[model samples]
Target: MNVKTEVKQIGLYINGKYVPSSSHRTFEVKNPATQGVIALVSEATEEDVNQACLAAREAFENGPWRTMSVAERCEKLRRMAEIILERKEEIAGLDAIDVGKPYHSTVQHEVPRAAHNIHFFADFVQMQGGETYPMEENFVNYTRYEPVGVAALITPWNVPFMLTTWKLGPCLAAGNTAVIKPAEMTPLSVSLLGEIAKEAGIPDGVVNVVHGLGSVVGTALTEHPAVDLVSFTGSTATGKRIMKNGADTLKKVSFELGGKAANIIFEDADLDKAIPGSIHAAFMNSGQVCLAGSRILVQRSIFAEFLERFTKAAMELKVGDPQNIDTKMGPLVSEQHYQKVTSYLEIAKEEKAKLICGGKRPELPEYLQKGYYLEPTVYVQENPKSRICQEEIFGPVVTLIPFDTEEEAIQIANDTEYGLNGVVWTENLQRAHRMSHSVRAGTIWVNCWFVRDLRAPFGGFKKSGVGREGGHHSLEFFTEAKNICIALK
Candidate 1:
């Protein structure tokens, strides 16, 4: 559980090389666990964004990366994955401090998952191929997939290490060069990827990392002329802004945006599993996850029993130092975000929802007093349209709603503008099928939560997101399709 207390400084990486910010300005990156300065990362200004874009463009247009054979690209990606695995502990430490994720979760899931994602894409792209069609006896038609050129990837702070690979894995696999802008609050772990790329022999300018506020560097990256596509993972509001900015260039924009997912438990379900499942879904990463099941819809038949068990499990969550392997939960990403989440608790009170457990911060030890912490919060509301039910709190908060029937549960689940993820807990095969078909979400976990297949399509519906990213879906997004026809006598 020991961590470094000394402050360090990090730099931006452009053209496969580390360089200071163009403006020579620096920003402080903090450990959300203790509110202590973790490192001073270069603050990438608009000019730095432009420089990174230029480097990416050069790499995509005339660099060896784009010209390399598919096998060669896969090999490089495997090397990078190996490097990531070898440094998993080191990376997990940074992730634990930077994002306030539990050390156990970071080391067990986030760190290893990132390395696996890269390897998945490396082999995934190799197995993927364009199709050839038989047109006529005298003619042949075929399809080719080409890189989308420069990609602008903007990752959020909550899952910086995982989401970076989520975008970069297939991006580089499909032969696109990129400039990533890690969230200002957590840039340390992502900035380290530049070194991993260099170690893997990923060519210069193939991958770039710029660290700064989203408004400055994010805007520049989205609007840059050389950028062909912009892939963003953050709030829905910011996703809308990126779409507007990239529209001028007619660039393709893919988003994995916000979600207020619903976890529906049927009366026939196993409460033993559903209780912990519901709690874990809502409180994972202190509820900073976009796909967090913030809404729990219970069948009216078992609503009382479910709420009692669910609240008990939520209240038992240990919220303290993320560095502790036994810690079940950690603080919010920052003081500002902590306020945003706590403000919603007041709204819940005003709306007259029953505050079952956790509307206040937990008492911490002396050394952790400065950390931004919030206890697991559960609210029971009869009205599905309540603000607490409708909005994305993006914290450890969940609103429990009761639904009369399967149809009502489906209606309540799909009632939101966001449809990123939905969960259904039912033992009946018929009910599971009906709920899965009826609830509108990119991912629906039946009898389980947060279980994922690397090859499955991952994204959202409605305003949750614009496109999917996983397996071949990601390769398609990062590349464009071209058709070629040949005529013979």
Candidate 2:
């Protein structure tokens, strides 16, 4: 199944078409589950990025796409969704190879949801428009939710298919053109999306994909003066850099950055739900996710019991190849990530935290030796200031800290500088709502963890980065208001 035999096995997608990079340089897409070269993708240089940017600008300002009405755009977007559903296999296979998600999840979840995302945005594009305000004077007053010229969308590799749709859906729905760069580590899935967009009858220059090192293409996308807005999803450190870069152009920026989400387990939480939900929150996506519940805050009354049940669940997760439908845990994204995660394990020991269960490699198939495998790990830290408790330990690792009072637990949860998300586990409704509000994160879950509705806003406060994504926030990112008035007799 050398699907790479297809036209863009690895190439830049610009003007609604795939083409080889002007810079002969290219990079290998690795299979995180196997650590093999999945495919060779074209690596765009700074110049190539400018080319994409120019095309997006031309499209936004003067091309046929710019003049297209909301009804026209929706028709094309809906057609793209239909094409995506028809090409779901190709898209799913690309995602699996590019990022090592399980085949079943790729085909069943990522591809289908992405198509619906396109359709979802298409459904609303026609309905969303500018507003008119009534004024006492004789002047006509109106406002438009107009496009913000060229948009630069940079997505991470963790959930490439899902988040690309998250960013692109609203950008397109609001009539903005884009130059999108999926993370270098997992560009294929979104590249496959490029093909679907072309097949869907979208005119050239509306959407462009440039796959390359972020240092080169990413820098160009964020800082390009032609880019009117930037939408990014990644670490806080990088988000800061992008923000600084966008400032040079005084460009609008929307970021979905880092998280060290707090997962609280109170004395009265139902152990059955709390136990499994905590494990799913911390270890889903092998804990490579940004919004993972990596910091576990437990009430002193149930700390020991929660740790016991939580560690038990962590140890039982099936650590094996992603291709296996039965495997609950897959490899981390890459060797770099694998090393980063393992080093944190050593950090826990040096910091003198109590290692609960599975902390090292799993003795699985010999082939996994070449992959980025990590067993689930949980630790009990003495305090909230522990380095592991504060940092984004982006792996199957979590630090559990105990607090006596509800007030203390809330304080501990809000202790981190990264207030991206949090989880509140309690049986009492009033207590759950209070605790959720008390936590400083942007989005809080009560009696649940890691669930999302696209219609809701998603982002963070403080160092977690600025602005928001999903729902109306996304459309707003792609729009800017302009006021015009004239004196009349």
- Winning candidate number (lDDT): 1
* Residue 241's lDDT in candidate 2: 85
Clashes of each: 0, 1
True-structure RMSD, every candidate: 1.0, 2.1
Which regions in candidate 1 have their CA more than 4 angstroms from the true location? Answer: none
Worst ten-residue run, lDDT, model 1?
1-10
Off by over 4 Å in 2: 1-8, 484-489
lDDT of 2 by residue, 310-345 (tens): 888888899887767777878888888888888888
Measured with C-alpha atoms, the lDDT of residue 99 in candidate 2 is 72
Give candidate 2's error at residue 421 in angstroms.
0.6
Per-candidate TM-scores read 0.98, 0.95
Candidate 1's TM-score reads 0.98
